[model samples]
Structure formats: C-alpha cells, structure tokens
Target: MLMSATSFLASQIRSTIAATVHSTNTLVTSLKSSLGYLGKDSSTSEPENQSALSSVPLRHEQYPSLQPWKGLDRRLKNYGYTMPVSSNYIAPRYPIVLCHGLFGFDKMGPDAIPHLQIHYWKGIHQALNKLGAKVIVARVPRTGSIIERAEDLHKILSTTMEGSPVNFVAHSMGGLDCRYLISHIHNKNYEVLSLTTLSTPHRGSPMMDWFRDNFGVGLLLQSEEDAMRKLGEAAKLSKEAVQEASDALHSYLQNVAGRVMSSGYRAAPNPSPISPLLNKLIPYLDTPAYANLTTTYCKEVFNPNTPDDPRVSYYSYGASVPQIPLWAPLGFPWEVIKAKEGENDGLVSLQSARWGEYVETVEADHWDLNNRWRLKIGYDQKPFDAIDMYMNVATRLYNNGF
Candidate 1:
C-alpha cells in the first residue's frame, strides 16, 4: 500500500527498536497528529493502538511519478490524498511493503533481510515497478500474527511515510495480518486505502493443523504464532457476539466444501519414510475452512472491522495446483493437492485465488506468484508473467485509490 512521509518515519523508528532491540513500538502519532512527544507517553494516556510495519520514505527516483492523487472521496480528504483532477493522479508506485510468510528466512548483514528464493519478489517487484510501484520487502524478528504485523506496519507508517497515504497488498497470511492491524489494533482513525490478501487461510487452513501438529509450528512466523494468538483471543471471550461470530464462521466453512486430508487426497506415497511418523498425523485433522472463505462461505468477510473500511476494499487470490503428486516442497506437500481438480499455480486453488474485492488470475504456482529461477521447470506448472499481475494491480490501486 502507499503511505506518506510522516507515517513512514514513525514506523521505522519503531521497527528498528522492535526487531533490532526486541522491544515494542505501540505509541506513535498519526500523520495528522502532532509528534511533540516523540518518545514520551501521554501522562493522562488514553487507550493506545498497536503500531504497524514502519513506512519508509522514498527518494524522488523511487516513485518517479507525477504529483500525488488529489482526490475528493471525502475519505481521502483526511488521509492527505488532496483534491485535484483525475489527471493529477500520482503513480502509487511510491513504496509498497512486501512481507514474507511464516518462517520466511531473513538474511544477516542487515542486507535488507535476504529473500530465501532467488526469484522471490524479483518478478513481482519488477512488474509492480514497471506499473509505477516501489516494493519494500520488510523483515521483522517475527510477525507472529497479522495483528502484530499490522501494528508493525502502523509503526512503519508513523516513522516512514508520515505525511503520505499508504496502501497495502499482502500475500496469504500477510493479508490476514493487515486485517488484524486495521480492525483490532487501529485506533478507529487512520485509513489504509485498500488491502488485498493472497492465499491467506483466513478461516484458518487445515494445513495449520498439519504444520504445527504434523510438521511443526514456530513463532518464527508471526502468522503461524497468530493461530495461537487468535485462539487465545477467541478463548478470552464469552460474549454472545463472539459465539455468534464463531458459529457464523463455522457454518460458513461447512458449506463451501473442498478436499480435506480425507477423500484420499493424501494417497500413494502416504508419508515419506524420512518423516513417515510425522506425516501420519496429517490425515487425522478435518479441514474446517478449505472453501469457507468463498462468497458463499459467509455473509461477509469475518472481521472485527469498524465501519468496514469504506475506503479500504478487500480482495483475495490463490493458486490451484490440483494434481500435486505424492511429493513436493517444504511449504506445500504433494499430498494436499494431488488428484485435485484444475491447476493451482502450485499451492492455492484458482477459485480461492479469485477472492479479491476484484480478482485476477495468472498461470503461476505459489512460486510463480513470486519471481522464479526462470527455467520454468515443473509438470503441470505454468510460467506466470509476473508483470501482468503486477500491472493489473498497479493500474487498479493507483486509478481506483486502493
């Protein structure tokens, strides 16, 4: 997402502290608020909000754009999008923040946290930039949860893009993290323009039951930790409202059915001899929300959202790798998609991938979602034109104001 200068600075200071020093940065000023007490807490403090990923300032060359959008959507008025003709549109390519998924490796030398895959984000970022967006791959000690990640983003906004309007387009769980930041942690003020999720197991993927119980789970991934965090949050509540929420969520998933570990989805190889005992645990857990996030799943996206982001719209995208053999990579095992229908770039179901406020589909796997080695090797795998997906989103976000 796009953010102003002031928002970026406040967030940076917080991230440098939270990640580098292992501290937290919750108290920060909104772009419009005075930063008079930079490091000081208000004496008669009111309820504080969690900060989000720090927004960063961009060099003029970074955005390389015309003036920022001067729109009058009333919502944009406060966020500093300014009011001007559509022709004065600013290319939103200023600074987009890209966050890695759970257990994503972060490199040392502080070399901007190296992305594990060589092709990771290289294609994605290049395409976004060609369409006028600057990509910022962010690293933290851990996102732990979308809410926490969102808070970090909030902090980034404060420290980095202090004066600018920011937009966020997150992948999978990252989208969930954005929602947590905007809905629960936010102080009911700031506007996030738009948010989109990619293959986010919003209702919770059956995969989690496998990852933690079968494979393993770690706080190394903020979103992974969030499963526990939300469980914790869910546990603390006894409100009738909360019960209704869970019930609604439950009812929703039961309807949009898909393959679980059952239906022989985990066949042939069964489990690898190397980790056969561990693999055995997978087929046990029932998939609760495989197809639940579909429009038919629930009446609406499950959110504690206030006003439901009149300005910020929601979208989702997923890959569909159906015929996954009995073996695959670490992130996605072949058992999950083997014998399924359609091709899911590699990990997400194409139908699931289409969950955008507006959806776009490309011929790519989960890896295709990112830049790849370019050799394009894989059966049933399609080489995605990252540039296409990038431009598709860029033109929409910039022109549509999300």
Candidate 2:
C-alpha cells in the first residue's frame, strides 16, 4: 500500500521463469538508452551535450529546495529537462496512462484541492508532460477487487481516450486492475499496447494473511463504519460527505484484504473472528476476488484463468530494500518482508512482482519505487530517482514504436 507502511518478512522467492535472456537484454538496452537520453554519450570521449548538462541542477541545494520531496519540482520548474539534440523530444506514439496502486488518489484530496497537488504518481506525470509525452493519470478507487477497480478504470478510459489504444504503466494492485481490464473488457476496443507493472503482487503477498490473521486491533480501526464515524466526528463534515468517504475507505480496505487473503493460507477463516466488531463491519471478507490473490489460487487458478494477450507486450519491474531504510515508518514491514521473502519492497516480494518480461530489480522499497524517497523528511542521502526510471520506460516504449 502507498500510504506509509506494513510489517512481515521472508527470505525465499519462488517463481517459474521462461526467458531470463529477455530480461537481461531489455534491461541493458533500456538503461543504455536512458543514459543516452539524459545526454550521456558512451560513444564520445567527452559528454555529448555539455551545454544541456551544464543547465541541469547537479546538487541538492542547487536545485533550490529545503524540502527533499519538492526537489524534482524545483528542477523541473527552473532548469527544465531536454533530450539529446539527436533524439526526438516527444517519444511515445500513443498516450501514456499512469495507473496507481492501493490508497492512490487521482487528485490530492477533497474537492477544494487542485489536481496533481499531491498526486499518487508524485511529480512523474509533470516531468513526463514536460518531455512531450501524452500522459493521463487514471483515477481508479484506491481499493477494490480487481473487477470492481477495473470497472472504474474502464469507465475512465471510455471518457478519457474514447477508444484509442494506450500504454499502461501500473503500480502494485493497479497492475492487477490493468490485467483484469485488458483481459475482460473487450467490448471497449481499448487496445492496450503494453503493460508495465511495478512492484506488483502477481502471486500475492503473505503480509495480507498476517494482517487478516493476527492484527485484530488494526482491523478494528479500518472497519468501514468505525472509520466513517470517527472522521465524521473529527472533521465535522456533512453527514453525506462523511458517509461517502467512509464507504470509500471501507471499499479500499476490502480490496486490500482481498488482494492477499484467500483459502490456501494459514490465516484463520475469512471474516476473521478475532474482532467481532470487524467481522460485523466487514462481513464479506472472503469473496472470489480475495480468493484470486492467494499464491495457491493465482498459481492454480487465476494465472490459468487469465490468458495473456499476444498483441500486448508485458513487462514487470520489481524492487527490494535489502535492509530497513531511513524511512523508519516503513522499516518494520520491510524487515518482516526481508526475513520471510528474502528481500522485498516492504510489501510484495520480488518473485511475486514478476510477470511477463522481467526487468531489472532496484534497491528501493515499494514507496521509494514511486519516488517516495524524495519525501523522506530526515533522510539526507539521495537514494535513487524514480523519475529517471520512468523516463527510461517511456523512452524504451518509444524506441519500440509505441
């Protein structure tokens, strides 16, 4: 989830792979192209575009931001980014749609806020827009079963692109939504050119089992009715508003739990009996949706149930923190996942995140994979820039003729 954090750990990654060579070649070519796109020239003795390189903000302070998270914004607003003179500024033939994971909000929050103020994709859309890519941020509900979320996304696609084909770049559960939509929503004529999933739980996560099993206290807090009443009391919002937000929160949690809690796990029976209040509030915990996410279900049922479209290229990019990071809030889950799954991005293990053409892995947690490291308040070390990674994705897509 994209909010703050979670807890659990594992050490082994299990998956059946088809072609490791495809992963290597695609990763190497993409990195090389991205480096070249940023004005680095391996062919030349010196920097090919020294003039363009001179304009880039080289240091954190030089970027003009005391807030680390806003550094990318400052750089974009001030210096701006330009591709090498040899390459085209605008790349992708089709529009790029950014699909967000759980807890993702299309706009910042509430009706009064401006769009993109606190985007789920952070400044990625802005940065891509600047580079002449046609980027549309899809606003599906933060949580829901793949079908429910996909339905929402399908409606958005109908309105946004009419029927034009698009390249989708999704994160976490968003990838599942994309896969669901691509496979099921055939009437829409929405030709999905490529699907790139980032740190998605393809085979599901055991963390969901742990949360549904032992965390009764936390579940009580998230149970729809409680969250709504609490917010209603705290914010003094209208009854209608509170109910709506509460319903959304509940739906989100339903999908979150649905993504991992299934029949195969050691988790106690669905509609966890640990908390009577939670059981009452979330009576429909074990649905077909939830069942679809279990490793057993996914491997034995869902994978075989869902067929990959030969026309649409599929790529997966997974991440791992290796160790607990400076983001203390995310450390618990990261550590837990590390211990149990070998290494993870605090949520989905790298193995669970793999799908089609497996891309290179990164030394980043799930949140940081979306450039959340930029928002680390106290951390001074610049880990990595997700912007570059995204740019590289767009570049590779462009190079491939879509």
Candidate 3:
C-alpha cells in the first residue's frame, strides 16, 4: 500500500510539471507573435508597401534603439512602444504652427529678462526649426473659452502667415481651438492645410467634470450669500453703502473667479476643510473652462457645433503612462481620471484623445507631450522623445502633401 501511494504522488507531480511547462511555452509563443517575431512568411523578400506599413501596427523590432527604464518589464512591460525615428525628418510643405493649450504661453518672462523667460513648447519649436521646418509658436489667452481662443488663434495665424497655407500642430486645449477655427472661422488670409494633435482631449476629460462637481459647485453654493451679507453689514453705516458695496463685491468676485479658475492644472488640489477666509475666497473662483471642457459639454454641445472641415486633414496621437508614482503631482487626478476612463496619460484618456486619422498611442503623460522633460521623474518606462514625435508629424504631413 505504501509503495502504491508513493508512485501515485510521483505521477501527480509529473503531471503538474508538464502542465506548467506547456503553459509557459504557450505564453512565450503568444508574446513572440504579438511582438512580430512569429507568423511571417520566411520566403517573402519584398519590402512592405509604405501605405500598407502605415496601417499595420508598429512592431517591437521597428524601434531597435528604444531603451526603456530598467525593471520596467517586471513592473509593467514596455512592449517597445510607438515613437518616431530620432533622425531624418522631412519638412512639411507649409509652415508648422505650434499652438499652446490651456494656461499656455509662448514665453513667460518679459523680453528684457530673456534669461528668465520660460517657453511653453520648450525645445520642440527650436528642434523643428533646426530640421528645416518653418515653426510659428502661437500665443493665445491662458484661460479662455474655446471660441475666444479660436478667434485669437485665427487672428495670430492671419497676421503671421500672411496668406500662406499653414499646418497646425496643437496640444491639449489648443486642438479644440484649432478644430473650432477650422469648422466655424473662415478666413481668406491663410489656409489651414492640416491639423495634428498630440494628447488633446478631443471628447473632453472626466477630470474637469470631477473638479467642477466636487469643488467648483460646492464652493459657489456655500459662500455667495455669506459673503454678500458680511459685505452689506460692513457697508451699512453709509446711506447707499450697501448697494455700492454689493456692486463692488460682485465685480471683484467675477475678476477673482476668472483669475483663480484660469490657473487650470496649476491650482492646488481641492481642499475640503475650508477656513472662514477660504470660504469667502472659494465661492468667487468661477471655472470659466468648465463649460468648455467637461465631457458632457463636449459631447452634447461643442462636438455637434464644431464639425470637421473637409478641406483640412486631421490626425491625432494619444499618450499613456503605465504607472503614476505616489509622489507624482498628477497622482490624485490620475486615479480620478482612471476610475472613469480605462487608460490615460495622467490628464487625457486614450479614448478621449482619439480624433481624425487616429495615428497611434505613445507612452507619455500630459506634460511629456509638450516636451517638458524636466517634469518627468521616476516614471520613465518608455523612451518616447517628444521632439522626435513632432518631427515625425511633420514627415507625415510632407508625405501626405499637406
């Protein structure tokens, strides 16, 4: 009986080992196929058609030099993501207009203080210009409605390009501005040949909705009456004092709201424990961008009104980071956005970023899309050079005869 039990136990162990080996082999084969290492006809020697290659998903072998961060495979497989070749970019036919997004600027400091000037596009504009592309960095309002931004963009383009056909490469909210311009604003001065958006929230972001619902609406509801009552009591000593004070308070609140809400992502996270002083301040901070950027607003209002122009070619690239570190500035917001949307680059989701041709998705966050390398820390799972990506866009436009 003992001998028979020992033999049975040995047989079970052998079976388990065999199963494990089979599963491992199957996984390896699947990975190989997904990475473009298997299922190819070995006899085929002809190069793939350029148009056909564009449609085919990029493979790991295509980017031989991409060195992802160490241990990234153990945490989250890099999969050798899609990024443009580092060199040899063909300049597009028309000048490339680089449009900044919400709360963006061409330069921050005054011209006299050139050493301290901070550029929105950073190294991107200079890199593109070096590659023989005529780059125009457009300056628009930091925090304005889409219509307002579009109007400003149109004016800038008309004056700068001067009847020259131009290609627009917009990031974040700038993409919406360009779309609005293309669809609604008709200008005879300059022609829009094409628009390529990088990580733009075309459909709108859930983060905006979350901010408005949780903090913006609550602040407005709780503080307005209290602030007015306090102001009225303070000004009651004089004969028309209350009325004058009320008017002054209303105007002051409007100005404060614009300034505060317009700060965009730079604003501090929503703090729940509102101090007495903060209660008065919070209610006055109106989100001017909320009406323009909420998912509901874009889907129900902006999209319906802003249809794509047939004359212009539209293409877009979305981005995503595998993980958001605990200490990352976008950590809380990333979780908030991820809860509603499946995958995102800490700001815009991959699904929401898709528009027009839908080129490809890269491994990056919102700031990384703008070529802000200094902002990226301890989250470099993939080597996605923003400069290279822009150059690739220019190359694509050139190839398409834009």
Best by lDDT: 3
All models, RMSD in angstroms: 20.5, 20.6, 17.8
Where does candidate 2 stray beyond 4 Å?
1-90, 110-116, 215-267, 270-297, 325-327, 373-382
State, as a TM-score between 0 and 1, how close model 1 is to the true structure.
Answer: 0.50
**What C-alpha lDDT do the candidate models reach, one value each?**
0.45, 0.64, 0.71
Which residue segments of model 1 deviate by more than 4 Å?
A: 1-90, 93-95, 105-120, 188-190, 212-308, 330-334, 337-345, 351-356, 374-380
Tell me how candidate 1 scores on lDDT.
Answer: 0.45
Model 1 agreement with the true structure over 269-289: per-residue lDDT tens digits? 224344766556543532322
The CA lDDT at 57 in model 1 is: 33
Ranking by TM-score: 3, 2, 1
TM-score of each: 0.50, 0.62, 0.65
Q: Output the number of the TM-score-best candidate.
A: 3
